[model samples]
Target: MADPTTATPASGKPGHRRRRVRDLRAMPGFTTTAWITIVTLYLPILVLVAFSFNENRSVVLWTGFSLDWYAKALENDGIRNAAWVSVKVALFATVISTIVATMAALATTRTKKFAGQGLVFGIINQPLMIPEIVTAIATLSLFALVKKITGLSGIGYLMLAHAAFCIPFAYMPIRARLETMTLTLEQAAADLYAPPLKVFTLVTLPLLGPGIVAGAMLAFVVSLDDVIITLMIAGPGETTLPIYILGAIRRGITPEINAVSTILVAVSVLLVILLFVVQRRMQR
Candidate 1:
C-alpha cells in the first residue's frame, strides 16, 4: 500500500467545513432584526395591558390596584353608544362581506373560463392590496357626492364603507379553503342520486362551515377595529368605537381606553380560539 491517507484530496477538509457552514445558514435561527421588531411592536401593548388595572388616573404611575376604570368605562354613555354602534356596524358588515366573499370564492374556484370572473375577483380583492387611506378617501369623496344629490343621512354610509374594507379580509380565507378542499365527496353525492341542493346542503356547506366562520370573524374584527375609513365616512351621531377611542386619546390617553382596548383584545382572542375548535372539529 502506497500510503492510503495520501490518496485523500487536499480540499476535503475545507469542503466539509464549507458544507457545515452552508447547512447552518440554511436553517433559520432568530436574528437581531426579529428581536428588535418584537420588542417594538409588543412593548406598548404590554404596557397598556399592565396599566389598565392601575388605580391612578395617569398611566405613568401605578398607585394601587383597582377595577374602577373598567367600571367608569362601562358607565360612560358616550363610550357605550359608540361601542354599540360599532358592534352593529361590524355585525352587518361581517354578514354582507361573508356572503359576497363566499360566492366569489365558489365562483372562482368551481368555474372554468367564465367571462368577467377575473375582473370580479380582482375588484373584490383590490382593497387588500391597495393603500387603505386611498380607499377611505375615495369612498368619502364618492359618498359626499351622493349625499349632495340624494340628501341621504344615516349609518348606511358607515356600513357601506366598512363592508368595502372588509370584503378582501373575508375573501382570502374562504378562497384558500375552497382551493384546497377535495371535490370527490360532492361528485360521490351526485353519483348517489342526490340532488344538487341536497348535495350542497348536506356535503358542501358543512365542509365549508369552518372556513366561512373564520372569514366572518376576521371581517367582524377588522370592521370593529377600523378607524381611518370609519372616521372618513361616519356621521356625527354615528360615531363608532374606534373614532371615540381616537377622540379620547387625542384629549389624553386614559386608563378607560386601556380597559376598552383590553376588552377588544379579549374578544378577538376568544373568537380565534372558537375558530380553532371549529376547524379541528371539521378536520375530524
Candidate 2:
C-alpha cells in the first residue's frame, strides 16, 4: 500500500514544510512601523489629555491631577461662545451637506453614465484635490466682493461656507454605498407598479440609512474642527472653537485649551464609535 504521508505530485518531492498564513501585524516590520506611527500621531494628544487636569498652571509641568482647568474652561465666556458657534455651524453644515450629497450620490450612482459624468464627479470632489489654503483664499476674496456689493455678514455665511466645503466629504460614503447596492429590490418594487416616490421612500432610503448617518457625522466633525476656512470667513466678533483654540495656542498653550481639547477629542471618539456601530449593524 502507498503511504498517504509520503504522497507527492509529478516532479514535486513531498511538499516543502506546509506554510502557514501569517497575520500582517506579525510580519517583521509591520508591528514596529505600526507602533512608531501610532506614537508619532497620538502621543501629543495623550500627553495633552493627561495634563488637562494638572494642578499647576504651566501646561508643560504636571503637578497633580485636578479638575480646576475643566471648571475654568466651562466658565470662560470666550470658550463658551466659540463652542456654541461651532455647534451651530457644524449642525447646519451637516444637515445641508448630507442632503446635497444624497441627491448628488443618487444622481451619479442611479442614473446611466453619459457625457460629462466624469466632469460632474470631478467637480463634486474638487475641494479635496485643491490646496485648502487656496480654497480659503479664494473664498475670502469672493466673500469680500460679496460683502462689498451686498453688505451681507454674520455666522450664517460661515455655515454656508462650511456646508459647501463639507459636501465632498459627505458625498464619498453615500456614493460608495449607493454604488454597492443591488438594483434587484428597487426594480422588483417598480415591476409591481409602485410609484417612484414610494419605491424610493420604502425600499431605497432604509438601506441607505447607515451611509447617511456616517456622512452626516463626518461632515459635522470636519466642520467643527475646521480652521482655515472658518478663520478666513469668520468675522472679528465670530469665532468657532478651532479658531479660538488656534489663536489661543499662538499666544500660548494653556490648561484651559488642553481641557477643551480633551473634550473635543472625547466627542470625536464617541462619534467615530457610533459610526462604527452603525456600519457593523448594517453589515450584519
RMSD of each: 5.5, 4.2
Error of 1 at 114 (Å): 3.5
Q: Estimate the TM-score for candidate 1.
A: 0.86
Identify the candidate with maximal lDDT.
2
Residues 157-202 of candidate 2 have per-residue lDDT tens digits of 8889899989998998888888889999999999999999999999
Candidate 1, pairs of clashing residues: none
Instruction: Itemize residue pairs with steric clashes in candidate 2.
Output: none
Number of backbone collisions per candidate: 0, 0
Which residue runs does candidate 1 get wrong by more than 4 Å? 1-23, 26-32, 276-284
Residue 79 lDDT, candidate 2, scale 0-100: 93
Give RMSD (Å) of candidate 1 vs. truth: 5.5
Overall local distance difference test of candidate 2? 0.89
Q: In model 1, how large is the Cα lDDT of residue 197?
A: 96
TM of each candidate vs. truth: 0.86, 0.89
For candidate 2, report its TM-score.
0.89
